[model samples]
Target: MFAIVFILLLFSTGDSILIGKIQNSTIIDVTHISLFNITLNQCICKLITVSGIIPAANYFPGNQSCQLFNFNNNSSLISSNFNTYWIFTNQSSAFITNTSITSTSSPTTSISSSSTTTSTTTSSTTSLSTTSTSTTTSSSTTTTTGCTNLGMFPYQSTYSVGVSPQSVAVVDVNSDNKPDIIVANFGSNTVGVLLNVGNGTFLSQTNYSVGSAPESVAVVDVNSDNKPDIIVANTLSTNVGVLLNTGNGIFRNQTTYAVGTQPWSVTVSDVNNDNKPDIIVANFGSNTVSVLLNAGNGTFLTQTTYTVGTSPMSVAVVDVNSDNKPDIIVANSLSNNVGVLLNTGSGTFLGQVTYITGTNPKSVGIVDVNNDTKPDIIVANYANTISVLLNRGNGTFLNATTYLIGLSPLSVAVVDVNSDNYPDITVANSLSNAVGVLLNT
Candidate 1:
């Protein structure tokens, strides 16, 4: 009697050539393997034992059914194989096997392979179980090497929001520990809040009317009530609207505060260090930024307007001069440059220091890109490039270095996505409908 023994192997990143691909060919055999109800490792191990050939397959846990399409030798999932994974909306997944048994010995030879698949809820680690059957050789199993079998989609769900949402903010409006989605619907002139009900699903959106053509939205705990409130930049109405969260994701009627003409963006921060959040708006039409100081109870004490370059589309509040005082960084759309307004003290900003950027600069982002402890500036220019200006610690910036990304970059964001400790850049290219990422080495 011949006993089949499976030997598992591990491949490193350099051994990618050994991985297999499913070839497109005429179907030769259609086999359904559903009898083995076991772990993913044992399932694929047994699968190769029976078929001796890899095939295109689909598996679902809902019915515990798996269909394998076998074409031929050339029809093998790959020229000759590792493991291939296919992801679906189904809870379970299917695999395309690519292992070749070069030669088979008689009764005592080990004939097995190990595969690791990851699931959303749980990840099972596989160990190489090399069962030796030779009488001269003592039977041994390597039980310590764990392979991460990854099958993840914790929240592979999607929900519908309103049409033409210009901007969004995520906050725990209902204090559920789950962040909910809030959007400014530019088309409908309303701010929509979709409360999270845990596990990636959100309740129906509740919309509150703001000003006409609301372009941006920000969330902060206004009125010191410890609840997240909503602030929207209504461009057509040339004002900022505040909607107080009346508990449980509900908001009261909006209270409007007049600002510069065509307010395109808004930000919330304690610019004055008063322990209260203030509202800042970028008025595109007037080439000005409005700073509304927070009076007691989330109310504003009128806005103080600051002169910047023409067509200031976006504004960022950060200490550009390393003085610990929050300054203002504005991306001037018409002037094709970025201007830094250093805060003198107590929310008073001095004249702007201009730094040239690419044509039609649209947005500003502050990041310490070079690990220099000083915050750097990133500008998104509509002329198909993004400009980086290194800060010189004292208000001024070095020359701009432009990186060609794609068509019409309208917004820029900086983050350390790959854990390399170096900051990376993400740009939203409006002309291409795709986002471009620039990773730092």
Candidate 2:
């Protein structure tokens, strides 16, 4: 008796995909013991068994499944002969009767010959399991190795109030190119303004109370005065507080506007096509996204209130559906999904697409992860882990791969810290009281 084995292997990568197969052409005649020259094809390699004496005019048949092994050094999956079999015969009458062969041995073979030529080669190969494992290991190692050992263990400090600061925005306010950080103290009624000293360190200048609670902040040229102004959401107050940057690392006289009940997050953008920037607040308590038009100066006029999902915490602007116009992306905290608001480009809401990430996604940053021109989303999940939603660039997002970093990642900031064009993610974890910075090695 004789047996044959065949195997097929398939894999892919971010840039390229591939598929291939290995087939056994000849079955070894082990009854009388014969050996024959097996013509190897460029794609198929004949595997032979060990401890078997080779006889002339015989071909070895693979008795087991061919294992297609992918080598890391080689760009393609390489197949080797390592399977084996055993043959036996029964002597009955005048001569020996035909006997069945069983695969009792593993096919362990020495290197006889190899087909090094390839018909077609792709620029990349995707071994998703290996790739995923490698990626996960590399990320874990990077998290443990690359972070700046600020060396100072974070000791509990008495903030202005016993509130957990969730978000931090750094913007150059004084025209000095040095960014000033404004921390949104979510648990407390106060917001801390840390003035950047241009040396990576910040000075605690002032901590001011906005409303009942402050959640998010954005610095923009709100009045077209060539100066950046601050817009913060007074969440509990159900309004937005506008603070004008005084050009001296200080903000004075915060103006308030009644927008909605329990506004969770606020962003400044040119939403109404008015050339002047407008304020879009995600009112979580009301399940609406409020659009406040800039009134030429530091004040705003109510434009429209569009309904969204529950607990809309973060809002982002992008050309999501590739309609050439900017669209809105809102991260709903309670719903665990990011709502996509298709911009009608005429100051009206057109449609929406809901996508979920990790648990409690509070903040989102758009960055091109796969060298694609389109931007991908990096979600900072508060309840669970971090996730990277790669943009397929076809009005759809690839399933997010959760990257474990730290406890309760509330904020994420991306920049080319190593001068590479690729952006590195640095997350500010609230509960751990440490920054989890991930460097793309």
- Which stretches of candidate 2 lie above 4 Å from their native place? 1-166, 176-178, 185-209, 246-252, 322-324, 416-420, 429-441
* CA lDDT scores, all candidates in order: 0.71, 0.61
Task: Output the lDDT of residue 70, model 2.
Answer: 24
lDDT, candidate 1, 291-373, per-residue tens: 99999697998999999999999899998777778999999999999888888778777888899999999888999999999
Over the stretch 1-441, how does candidate 2's per-residue lDDT look in tens digits? 233233222233332212222232222112222112222221122212212221111122331222222222212222122343222112121221222232322323222232321111112112221111000001111111232322222234333432878566778877778877777787877777777778666665477778877878787878877778878898889889888877676777688888878888888878657788888888989888888878887788864788877888778777756667667778878777777777787766665677778888888887776677887788898975888887777667877888887889887877777767788999989889899888866
Number of the predicted model whose TM-score against the real structure is largest: 1
Off by over 4 Å in 1: 1-85, 88-158
How far out, in Å, is residue 255 in model 2? 2.1
Model 1 scores worst on lDDT over the 10 consecutive residues at: 117-126
Number of the top lDDT candidate? 1
